[model samples]
Target: MKGMIVSRPTEGDLPVSLDDLGAAARERWGAWVTERHTSVVPNAVLTLEVEPPGEPEFTVEVMRGPRSINLDGTPVQNYATAAWLRSLMPADAPRVIVFDDAWSMHADLTYGCTAEGLRAGTVDHSVPGWDAGDPDLY
Candidate 1:
């Protein structure tokens, strides 16, 4: 089902430096990234909208520290797709939450990004229509 994916840094993971993030964005996304915004006063937040050369565009909201990095993109079709999306963030991110309201059960699907690789799990609650898996919602 279509959903929103959010990845966050664990206690052990270091906060990504703004410079490193900027370089990483350029390296990983290059000119494919159409827009970039950063807030540094109250808090450091970097937002990027990436539209690959062709189809399938997405938006990423990155916050400093342990705050969550919300990623709303094309619905993952397979584990590889999920992994690719996860790769967009720092490798230290330990888990990702996938929320899909279309599911009659819980809407959140949690995935652990461990050294052993991604592990899927169930969430206790639901966030109905969180993103409705819509890119335009960004």
Candidate 2:
């Protein structure tokens, strides 16, 4: 019944502005970042780590939503993880699940649903940037 949410920036997408990012975080996590700017790390990439109480560790990334782009390229914006989470959660479930490890410099941001939830249809979402082909991918 517990999990984590992780996020990072994506390439070739609408450069997620600080304001948009803060709004998205507030909507999703109910918390706001006090400061915002381009990450000092090169490549314009960032990882937001999250750890929920008594839940499996997981992560999510901030990429251009699918609707925000076309095969030929164009400007568009769409719901990303929230929609995916809604699809996985039961319609009747109350209280949104969130994580506390919001910012970590060296943390892994890979979302993971509990085994029981996966079996019970409580959490069913595909993880991106994860390759099951590798022996240690999980």
Candidate 3:
């Protein structure tokens, strides 16, 4: 999910900036900024590589979509990015119920589905983790 800096929490959607999502991913997802490119798309996605223990290290694009953190090969469709982030830790922890205080972490679960161009320029085919021929989002 995306991140935001709100003056006050509103019941409606929170205004999330590209930078906000980047900060949140770095802070909560154990992600390190891999690349910052303007040519990626209108969103100008902030790509981050996550090296979770025991799991294949992969990329997570912050500001990936309207309300999601797009993982490279291991895409998380409707799931909470924060929970998925934490799940990638040394071990998967119990899922936490996301509250209003942390809406960015709360997302629905659509495992492995990705939007077009989500992995456009970010995947390194030379790398072993993302060479699954890619998936066509149905």
**C-alpha lDDT score of every prediction, in listed order:** 0.48, 0.31, 0.38
Clashes (backbone N, CA, C under 3 Å), per candidate, total: 0, 11, 5
- Which ranges in model 3 have alpha carbons more than 4 Å from their true place? 1-14, 31-35, 38-43, 62-69, 73-138
Estimate, for each residue in 1-138, the C-alpha lDDT of model 2 and write its tens digit.
222332323222332353555455556655322223334434433333334345333333332331121111110111224333433433443323322232111122223433333234322224443434534223
TM-score of 1: 0.49
User: Model 3 shows how many backbone clashes?
Assistant: 5
**Cα-based TM-score, every candidate:** 0.49, 0.28, 0.35
Q: What is the alpha-carbon RMSD of candidate 1 to the true structure? A: 8.9
Candidate 1 structure lDDT? 0.48
- Candidate 1 residue spans exceeding 4 A from truth: 1-3, 8-14, 38-44, 64-66, 77-138
Q: Please write out the lDDT profile of model 1 over residues 58-123, one tens digit for every residue.
A: 766565662545455654432333444455555554444444444322222223333123333333
Residue 37 Cα positional deviation in candidate 3, in Å, after optimal superposition? 3.5
